[model samples]
Target: MKNKVTAALIASAMLGCLGTGVYAGSNLQEIKAYLNPGIKFKVDGQPVQLTNSSGAVITPIVYDNNTYLPVRSISNLLGVTVNFDGKSNTVELGEQTEGVSIAKGFDSSYHTKDPKVTIYNGKDYKDVFFDNGSGTRGSSFMLYPEGKYQKLYIQIAAIGEDLKEFTIQDSDTDTVLKKQDVRVEDGLVTIEADISGVKALYVHGDAKSGGSVFIPLTTSYYK
Candidate 1:
């Protein structure tokens, strides 16, 4: 009887260890450490992660009093496929189970030689610095609709003597939406557009000149 009780206790302890990490009590945190910022988490049908500015995998984020991991690394570890569609401006992470459903990554911010707020969806996995492996100064984002917002917003650092102007247009259309001269002082300038029913959006701003941004719209997204 004594030997059986001891074996049962040992088994119970091992089972508890299986659900937790060495340093952390929560297994989710360990899983999240591998995910990219802005990739939503759904384990056993519950939301669990959020993205902060592009931080190194070593750097941890604390939100709602809980720490989270990056979505990029974690999902891949879970045997999920992650992909980006530049032509469609989409980033997607496949579902864990079979049949391959994109659970997140739509409108998720991506890096390019030139980046823009590129229609963020799942999570706003945006980085603070606009540098995308290149020294070129540009930015991009992909935004998902949380409420009643269809319009997109852009903000450029206002700086001294920097020629600032932006060209907004639809990539699918020959028509140019608007091109305006911008005066950026103190290293900041902000631009807003009322994109009601735009199918595709293209922007080129001369933080002096030369860049590309593509934004797509869904019918139910903007009202």
Candidate 2:
């Protein structure tokens, strides 16, 4: 019975598959370079500002050999519930399972072993090699090292404040959750998942400019 249940979950993949190599268990930095096809939002009849369509798509993202997009816009147009935690810098779209989570975030502070990582939001704030990565409203994903938590911080954010769009599975898993319409009050977001059975957490981004940021094989067992 347990095998059947697990099989159903794995086979259905309500959230879609991560990729060929994106294992449920791995130690390498989980950064998928797959260019996800996406749709643009439209209002009335033409491509307007708000998200009314879920068929138009944006091209692939060419970066580090990975394709990224804004996630915020995608969730909204798709009619999914979304949330962004600014304080903790994370995003949660849709519900995992009765309030469970398929969430992600970034912490530029994750990679302590590597000295070159000094950029925040893709910018150099302290003269170090940090990258500053933020989202406005689109589909994109990214992964960062959060040493404080001894885990990689995954993120799913929209691009530009420009109101972006994205694509997702439809139901059950992680892909087709929703837009980050709701905001986490404390900036501290949490997820209760079976991390033991799950080898890693995922960092997803939305489409805005550089697209969304993601970190595969990302960990999130905050203890």
Candidate 3:
């Protein structure tokens, strides 16, 4: 007696859980759902725990003989990122254009050397990197694409009340691929670079008044 559930319904439920007022539609219907706490999940024959982003445990929901799982939890189990764009009312799975996070393939050697490089999450952004200011110039970091990605899409902005300049350069040739100056008031500036055939990238930021630079993780993707 498995029954198909609409994405709208799932989204509605998620929003309700989040205490958001957004509704999927006016034709919403209510159904009795039972929480099955005894159920377990496994991936590739290995057991896995189900939890939301808050680390709260989640269980399968049984409704009309059909089982439903939290989309975010299931996506996380499969090594996928789930994002909801409230403005567009859409759910995005994985990176846009079949891309992955530059953070995923970050060079580990620089981790100890560059303490200013940090992964950050905020109310407006998720899984992003913040280049905390260093000296008169802003912070910088390196990422290894390994020639697997053809394009890189990112949003950059000044973190605090200051203006900042950003540059993306080819690590091998030191060739500047893209440069932009962003202000905190201007918001996140989108940058698209043709990273075709490039192996490594050096991202640099220079601030006017010693402020940090922001690069979103969920929105930035390499394809």
In model 1, which runs have C-alpha deviations exceeding 4 angstroms?
Answer: 1-149, 158-161, 207-223
Off by over 4 Å in 2: 1-196, 210-222
Worst 10 residues of 1 by lDDT: 95-104
| Candidate 2 lDDT for residue 81 | 33
Worst 10 residues of 2 by lDDT: 144-153
lDDT of 3 by residue, 32-148 (tens): 888889988676678989787678888777877767766666655554435566767765554445668766755432222232343333344534566554556655778776554
- Preferred candidate (lDDT higher): 2 or 3: 3
Better of 1 and 3 by TM-score: 3
C-alpha lDDT of candidate 1 relative to the true structure = 0.36
Q: Report, for every candidate in turn, its global Cα lDDT versus the true structure.
A: 0.36, 0.32, 0.63
- Which whole-number lDDT from 0 to 100 does residue 143 have in model 1? 35
Best by TM-score: 3
TM-score of each: 0.30, 0.21, 0.47
**For residues 87-174, could you state the per-residue lDDT of candidate 2 as single tens digits?**
4444444432222112223334423324344333463322221123543433333322121111122222222222232232222234
